[model samples]
Every structure is written in C-alpha cells, then in structure tokens.
Target: MRRSVELEIITEALSKMGPHTPATRLWGRAPDATADMAAEGNVWAGDVHDVALHIVTRLYGRPGTPREASPLAQAEDAKRRRDMGDEIAALTGAHDQLTSAPWYPARPGDLVHVHYEQAGDLPPFGETYIVGHVGAGLMSLQLLAHTLPETVPGLDAEATAAMAGCFAAEAADCPVYEAWFEAGPRSLTIVRDGRPVHIGGAP
Candidate 1:
C-alpha cells in the first residue's frame, strides 16, 4: 500500500480510541536489548504502539502488560495547562510528567490483523519500525500494523521535506509527519513538530 493511504487508515483508527495518538517511544543509546536497566535508552519505533509500550514498561514502574494503564494520570494538569497554550505556565503551575505513556502492545506477535516483523524476520541493526503520536511532547503513540520491505538509514527524502515544511508551518498549521524505510539503507531524520528530532530512514 502507499504511505499516504497507510497514514489515513492509521489516523482514522486512532481517532476511535481518543483525541490522542495511538503510541510513543524513546530509543536507547545501545541498540541491543538486555536484562539490565542501565543499558536501555530513548524511545524509538516506526510506529507509536512500539514506543508507547516501551515507555510504560520501562520508564513508569508498570512492568506488566499495559492493557489500559494511564501514564498521563500524573501529567493531567500539566497537559491541560499546555492545551491552554501556556506551556511555560503549565510547567511552573502543575508538574507531574513522565518520559512516555501506556499503550497497546507493540510486538508484532501480539497484534491480530496488523502485519509486522518477528524475531527471525528482523534485520541486523533493527527491524524497520513505526510510531504514531498525538498532541504535544509525544503524548500518545500507536504502533503501525505493517512492515517495510527494506531499511534506509540517515534520513528520508519525503520525510525531510516534510520536516523542513514543519518549521515553516508550525503555529501557522499543525505539523504532520510520515517516513519510510528499507533494509541496506541509512536512516532519515525529519523535523515534524518543529525540527528533526529523530533519525528516520528508508530501506
């Protein structure tokens, strides 16, 4: 399927859940997964659900399944204040925030109808992933149900163009981003909300 169609399906499905994005994540400096906590790092994914689950299980203390856990319960007031367009005031007013939030499962093995990668299917560096989020500061994330045929590293052409447009569109228009990847290619970095904050690639 085309990337544009995929994004539309995602946006509609996520809307059914709530106003927020379906998932989020932070990537770790170390690429390998381990039992030790110190080794883990930031939230990263091709989709939101992957990152969201990472945040819930790692950052927050909910080590089990994230069926309906609300990571935002702590940031309610802060989120509300931000919604009012007073982020500075919100940070100083009421502050209870976390690195990420709780969301549906990210592992491809868990999803019912969504296509994804398995342990053996992943490539050497990593499996091409996707993460979808809503609002500011990546408040919500949802994993994509599909997988890319290859991986591209460093940056994505379309996504990069979109990021450049984001800086010009910010405030004037809400930002939206989409990236594609394939194996044997570097990552692509795109600035969606404001500037290119993460590495995005196409394979």
Candidate 2:
C-alpha cells in the first residue's frame, strides 16, 4: 500500500470522530508499533484498526485500568487540558503580537542587546547579551566577551551560549518586551548605552 493511500484511510477513519478531535491524541498511539510495521513495509496493510487501537491503548491505557492506584493519574486529565489551554493562549496572543510588530531585516553582523532576568533563586538582575545567528523568527545570542565577573569564575563560552539560549526562550513570554517574529524580517528592540537604537533606520 502506498503511504498516501494509508494516510487517506487514516484521515477518513479519524474524520468520523469529528473535527474537534485533538490531532496529537490521534497520532500519539502506538508510535513504536507503527514504526516497526513500516520497517517491514506493511504499515498500510489491513491492520490500520489494530495500529489505531495500539495508539489509543498507549494514550488512554487498557479498559478497566485502575486510575486510583496511581498518584500521578489523579489529576492528569485536568492538568493536560489546562496546559494545552495555556499553550493555545500563548500561541494565539503572544505569538500573534510578535509576528505583527515592527521588524527590521537582520544582517550577519548586526548587534542585538537582549535584556532578560536571571534564572533561579537570586536577586532580580538584568543582563545584556550579544546576538549571533539571526533568523526571521529566532535569534541565537551569547554573553558579551570581557563581561564576565571574577566572582562567577570558570564560566566558559559554551556555558554562556547555553544559558543565553534558555534566557531567549523564556524572554519570549515577557510582557515588558514586545518582541516576536513572523515570515519576513526579524523584529526586536536593540538597546545601546542605556538608550534605544535603530538598525538601518527602522522605527
């Protein structure tokens, strides 16, 4: 059976479950079993129902399975829905805000100063980072050279880069900075010497 045909069958069957069915739940079933079947080149055979059942078993487990026995299962469904709701809200609100903001086409040597709060338990402090690789939606940055404090000691470039990446992802949730990305040019506010600066005269 061709892959396209198999997909068509799966789509038709799943469509019967209604349009609002979560795609993740539909695809989350029996991933390993599907892969094994595919390795044998027989995934699109007459076992589509079996493969789908495998997926449902993985997601919801066997019928009559005791949920009260496990502490972790107590609030799993509620938590999953809540987390999914939060994710959808962020993607719709913050993501939309970012993609629609003013943008400038980033260059190879462009400098970006990212203002982010430090992680973990410590006095709240902001640090500056230098941008490295820049894309329309994402930018990689690292700590500025010669900016490390003597007290920190042994913080190498690799560690700094890793930390910067974490901070950048976290900073996306920050309301103070109206930074987001879309298809064309990258959008972010660049600050220098305690003042806002524009690149290529972008407002």
Candidate 3:
C-alpha cells in the first residue's frame, strides 16, 4: 500500500531534520519568522519557539572598504555556520517540546505538520518542493518557485536533487519523470502508472 500524500509530506519534512538537531524549534533558529510563514508547524513547547538562526558568516574579518563579493562570501560563510549551529539547537529544543506537543497525536487531514528532527535553517535560495498526491493514478508535483523580480535568483541543484529523490516511488512507474527531469527546476512532473507527465513551469 502506498503512503498517504500528507504522510509523505510530513515524512519529507521530518527527514529534513538532521541528526544532532533539536526537536523544539525544528524550523530553524528564528521560530517567529519561519513558523509564522506557516501556522501549522508552530507549536514548540506550546508556544512559538525562537526560530531565527544567527547568521554569522563574518568571522574571518570585517567587510572591506569596497564591500565586494569576496568579503560578502566570507560573511555568508560565517552566517551559514551560525545558521547550522542554530539548527542544531532547534533540533534539541523540538525534541523536548515534542514530548508534550500535539504532534504526537497527529490526525489525518493535517497538511502542515513539522518534523522535529529534520529541521534546518531556511536556505537563502532555492524553492521548497511541496508534493501532492491525488489518488486514482495521478500525483501532482508542486514547486514553490523562488525568484527575484529585480535580479536573477540562485538555485541549489543539489538540494533539488535531494527533494527529487524523495519522489522516487511515485516517479518509478510514472512517465512524468522524464519530462520533468528534462525541463529542470521550477517545473512539475506528475507520475501516473509509472509514467511522468509534464505539468508546467513553477510560478
């Protein structure tokens, strides 16, 4: 029997919570900013947990006079590390909170469930893949397109790869995988009878 679509999403979200991460505040370091975006995932310790990761990518040195990419890169690196550290903390906190949170008694029709262990700091770029399965031989693939109107936004191919891997079971027997794979990011592929059907580019 195939897993429910909501279960798949919950599992997918939970899988993101990496090892050594806290269960409380699993949605990164700044709970307010991250969880507030989606009300479903905000119940750490029966309250809103602090979820903002302290971006610290500036330890190497201060910004240069010109403030070029080199200095910016350094700052970014530091921030990434800090974010990672904050993620770890969230994992722990979530663990403690889960003991009392309603997550354990989760019921059906819950579209927005947060996994305590797999939470990580929201990436600077890249879109979150929201998977939807409509039974009767069709699963809809939704991509939360991330882009900038002013500038070309960056994409994390590796992260996309990871998210794609999770859809293997549905894609294994669907024809949509080929078309979706060819079109690339911000695209959707539906799998039916092991065939992936090209949906369209993400908005």
Query: Which one is best on lDDT?
Result: 2
What TM-score goes with each of the models? 0.15, 0.31, 0.19
Off by over 4 Å in 2: 1-83, 118-121, 132-140, 145-203
Model 2 lDDT tens row, 41-126: 44333344555555433332322332211112322443677766434443444344334435433333334543333334322233
C-alpha positional error of residue 45 in candidate 1 after TM-score superposition, expressed in Å: 35
Report the lDDT tens digits of candidate 1 across residue range 1-203.
21222234443454345345443422344456554546325333334444343333333222332221222332354366665433333222222221121221222122111122233534233222233333353422223223332433444656533322111111111111121111100122323333333332321
> Model 3, which residues run further than 4 Å from truth?
1-90, 113-152, 156-203
By descending lDDT, how would the candidates be arranged? 2, 3, 1
- Model 3 TM-score on a 0 to 1 scale: 0.19
What's the lDDT for all of these models? 0.29, 0.37, 0.32
Between prediction 1 and prediction 2, the one with superior lDDT is: 2
lDDT of 2: 0.37
